[model samples]
Target chain A: MDDKLMLMIPGPTPVPERVLQAMAKHPIGHRSADFSAIFAEVTENLKWLHQTKNDLLILAGSGTAAMEAGIINFLSTGDKVLVGTNGKFGERWGKVCAAYNLDVQYITAEWGKPLDPNEFKQALEADTAKDIKAVIITHSETSTGVINDLPTINQYIKAHGALSIVDTVTSLGACSVPIDEWGLDVVASGSQKGYMIPPGLGFVSVSEKAWKAYETANLPKFYFDLGPYRKNAAKNTTPFTPAINLIFALHAALGMMKQEGLETLFARHDRLRSATRAAVKAMGLPLFGPDECASPAVTAVMPTGVEAEKIRSIMRKKFDIALAGGQDSLKGKIFRIGHLGFVTDRDLLTAIAALEATLQELGHTGATPGAGVAAAGEVLNR
Target chain B: MDDKLMLMIPGPTPVPERVLQAMAKHPIGHRSADFSAIFAEVTENLKWLHQTKNDLLILAGSGTAAMEAGIINFLSTGDKVLVGTNGKFGERWGKVCAAYNLDVQYITAEWGKPLDPNEFKQALEADTAKDIKAVIITHSETSTGVINDLPTINQYIKAHGALSIVDTVTSLGACSVPIDEWGLDVVASGSQKGYMIPPGLGFVSVSEKAWKAYETANLPKFYFDLGPYRKNAAKNTTPFTPAINLIFALHAALGMMKQEGLETLFARHDRLRSATRAAVKAMGLPLFGPDECASPAVTAVMPTGVEAEKIRSIMRKKFDIALAGGQDSLKGKIFRIGHLGFVTDRDLLTAIAALEATLQELGHTGATPGAGVAAAGEVLNR
Candidate 1:
């Protein structure tokens, strides 16, 4: 009980001390002027982090709720939507759409492979009626450590006159995702990822184009309805009782992010990603995604001869480090190392050292002693 | 900002220091054994709090989300449901049902008035085909400070062979709501109200009858689906990333409640309610609801000649006390004082004193000095 494990999972990331303290503060009335001021600041800072001048609404649920909101709020039943599937999250978009009885055209790629922008373009070109209402893509697939090319796919969607809805759950604060620049109509993310807060709040930024669709979109929505959120946002309040403590934590976390600045934040993630990949490669483990398409938030490593679960167990038991296991079909095949949200160079180094020790303990002796640490050190020093 | 305001809103009540400190703890992996144990304990404690052996699942949203889940997961499109509407939350149930395209037969009562059980009984009796799938009622209508007769209405629902869905957001911990004894099919609540925690987590306890209805209910649901929640609950986990910090806070808050015991908790609320009503009467103000039907959680007062908004502003600006303003149609007509959750005798005395001063300051001199506080003290001493 005295030992606290390092949380190196994709989300439920390590929260900053300031954010935790902020959350610990006595709650204020949600409708009070003080709360409105805090909420307004959080909204503006979230916009700055997302690099979007769109309507970003906060929801009190997981990222999946935001994803479901993105789908149901802008499209009706039987509406044609082109969904791209490359990992668990990408497949989730299709499932959400199908649950709402949408007519879905799935564009899938192999797991750990990036979705081809040309495939989406071809699909749009083949739809002679231009009935595809929206094109949904996962910006960073946490499951397989792949970053889909959002700029190209969104451009294709724009050219085809279809709305671009993106799931930026693990990408918003880790890297550059300019919603307005990319012409993304809907971009959704969660607070636990890249925001350095615990999982409770979900955010979605909607474009003017998406609001126009919302005028007539006939999907059933109550709790996830963005209309009331938009209405309440004008007054710096939420339609329902929000997660007030999380909003306090978000305000503190966003202040920290503002102090760090976006460029430095992105570069920090880039450096950590590079250092982690260098360490994994030096340890003779195969990176799941191609180097060109790898995500900056989490890195999935495919063990050659050792059981992935065994390595994770060793890391948890001996090193007190919690690594993310693979999801869906990738379970026990690949283990993930997350470096998102409040993860520092020191933390990454510790994780890398633990991975090396665990791999060695599991009889994977292909790598030289201290090789992985040295590789990561060179990247960190630079 | 130096003067911390006392939060007296219906929800987002003042969180205890122990709960806040518990929430400030570091993040834990949701799938870890540590989190599982905490979650399982929280679930069991919640069941004890709910007084039911049913499946109680925690969700990361407001009470509205839990209400929506209760409606959508047990009824499909075009399913007829009898909805009782008295205040904002009651009307919200019908709106949620309407959003999901449910055939809602609304039994209406005026704001600040409790619904007549005969209306539901008559409506159910008139239905020759027995097609009313469920009867939804708000156990404690926060908007009007009215407590509906759940025991009586549920008896009517049971006799009519209809499921009883209850919204116990403001009633669960403040009063005795034994779901098993009351025969409630689905009882929903939120964390912030009576649980002495901040808002984020919504809970719903589903009975075996509701689970049977779930098998045939065809409403579209993803994030709020109880099927996955039930499957994961066996292992003490959630289908999505829960608001972990709130769960920690809930554990501490529930422990405090357990130590205090349920009978003591209900008596505390009852004492506070009596004190508040006495103070309101002593101040020569009109209580909104009938004395027999007033809620034990909050007391709504209809001030004569003085604007409710002005009183609230005075309370906030001068004394740093926040009293809840009325909602929707009741706005400006009534103001509510909440004494639920972690409120103490000193807090109630202070609120009463402040209310009297504010009323007098607003030129209402009907009441004598210290009369309200003296009345409240008499009740507190008992």
Candidate 2:
């Protein structure tokens, strides 16, 4: 009833009405002939979106589940994994690995900063015996709104003979992530972010190299057994019963994505990111991440002397616009606005206007109310 | 655009319009104040729906994932578990346990039959050393439409000092399952079944005994960690980025269930099931399971010499209805019609009528068009 509620979080972007209708339809047979057609179409579209020819499998879980699947499926217990830790999701990889009793080596960059490709090369070179089985990194760290140089780093890992697992949860469709070209062994993604569908389905594009690790690796797994999933997926069915509604929704969203074209979608996100950053700069808010590595999905703004929580709360309660505040050590320090999937320039303008009003209410001001929208409009119109 | 499509499969039932709209809303902050409110409300309702005051945690995964979480969280590699295998899902539970390297012993019932309570008692009594850490059973076997007697079986497990894990994926909301009173240590459910939502979210309610086993579990788990999930859930947040859109839809569906009251919902399912059985009998079709053990969620019919696949295909193409064919060896011999979640008397009558036409076209049957509707309406009206 309240269409005014605007979500500017990192994911679960608003779905189109058509996609919702498709999902809302009566549940189909997960193993039926009709669903097989739909399943094949979705798989083809997913590979197209990822720019890969690898066997893409869908899991009826969150993006984190796919990430965990990548970990346990590729590495045995006590196996060493090189984790790139710059933001929340990267740290999660390390923590999950540690929890699973893996020997974890964590490489760090400051929060809101991207990891260097040369540093990655150094880490791999340091492991002369090739103890490190995989290098795990996030393409877009939603927490800090930073996009690392995945292509270069993945190349480094490939050259050193270590597998690369990339978390493309936030950047898959919004940016050009060429999975095959980047030599990523396993790329994990969720439906809610760039796919413009409801959350519930996660996908992993597994390279032949990753599949090789899967055969000999010894770790506990059942529901996410990539082996059975790949085997059954050839017939367009899951090893287990899937979230059938979400699959229907995925089919619809993929169709829409195909119609829009991936290149055009990436360009749209690019323009949106540029406009949002320009507006933030126009409002005199310092950007959280380095300019060269800012994420296209979300923008993190560091408002001087202003508590991010207060601004987020006011925008949410007063204008029904939900913005994300910082997590962990950065809480109440930086606020983030998402302009990802299904997000248009008009939505960005709406968020900017709400942010402006909320900022003024919180007693921080450097620009007029209309200046943010106008600056963003300049890029959007072009 | 075709609103008349009937869902007679076990899961991914027809979602309500309100729930669909809720899911279509843009993704919200996973940890924001508003998202917390939603998470809190969904948990509260789920607790009531599960009929337990235990620690109920939500995972952004399918029912199998929740089952895996229950297994790996409580059992070690060499631990012994008693799995009751009657149909597909039960065998799946055993396979997953085996994959986890657990020593599993099976007490199997023939397909279309419930597990004998005495069988479980004998198994436990035979193991005087209490080597069996847990006993797993499916409350309602989706593959066979058999509802096992849980309360008596759980009592047997309790007397033997072993915990009980029940898969109530298909029966949680369709029938009355007094989880805490029945001593169910862990109850796993999915959204696509009786919860009246789409697939993707799996819920597990853990008892004190199960929580105690968690302290000693040495298996590999990270994203499905109940410890972190329980701790973060106290603050109404998930440890990882949640499937936000599905949660929104779940909240809406749960709200609708609460308004109707659980007891009434259960009773309605029971009546509809009775009428459906009467209709099948009147058509001279033999039911798959025993009358006393038939699940309220769905009815599996053995249509004599008629082909299940052909009946299913005719129903889908001509009547726009989807019926579930049998799995494994029973395939093409039996068909299932689901009456769980969001089904009304009118829906049942419509499905039955279409089934009659399809069955007759396939050169089988002895019933008039209105006989099934009449049988169902009599019970509903009473």
Largest DockQ belongs to which candidate? 1
Poorest stretch of ten by lDDT in candidate 1 chain A: A1-10
Q: CA shift at A335, candidate 2, in angstroms?
A: 1.1
Superposed by TM-score, candidate 2 places the C-alpha of residue A62 at a distance from the truth, in angstroms, of 1.4
Question: Residues A1-382, candidate 2, lDDT per residue (tens digit)?
Answer: 2556777888777778888878767666677777788888889999999999999999988889888887788888888989998999999989888987889988899999999888998989888999999899999999999999988888789888988988999999899998887778999988889998877788998999999999898988888779988998899888877877788888888898899998899999999999999989887789998779999999998888668788888988899988888888998899898889998888998888888888788877677767887899898999
Candidates' DockQ values?
0.89, 0.60
Local distance difference test scores for all models: 0.92, 0.87
lDDT of 1 at A28: 88
Q: State how far residue B272 of model 1 sits from its true place (Å).
A: 0.6
Cα distance off (Å), candidate 1, residue B104 = 1.5
Residue-level lDDT of model 1, residues A269-316, one tens digit each, is 999999999988998888898999989999999988899999999999
Backbone clash count for every predicted candidate, in the order shown: 0, 2
Which whole-number lDDT from 0 to 100 does residue A266 have in model 1?
97
Place model 1 in a CAPRI quality band: high
Candidate 1 has an interface RMSD (Å) of 0.7
Which regions of candidate 1 are displaced past 4 Å?
A1-3, B1-3
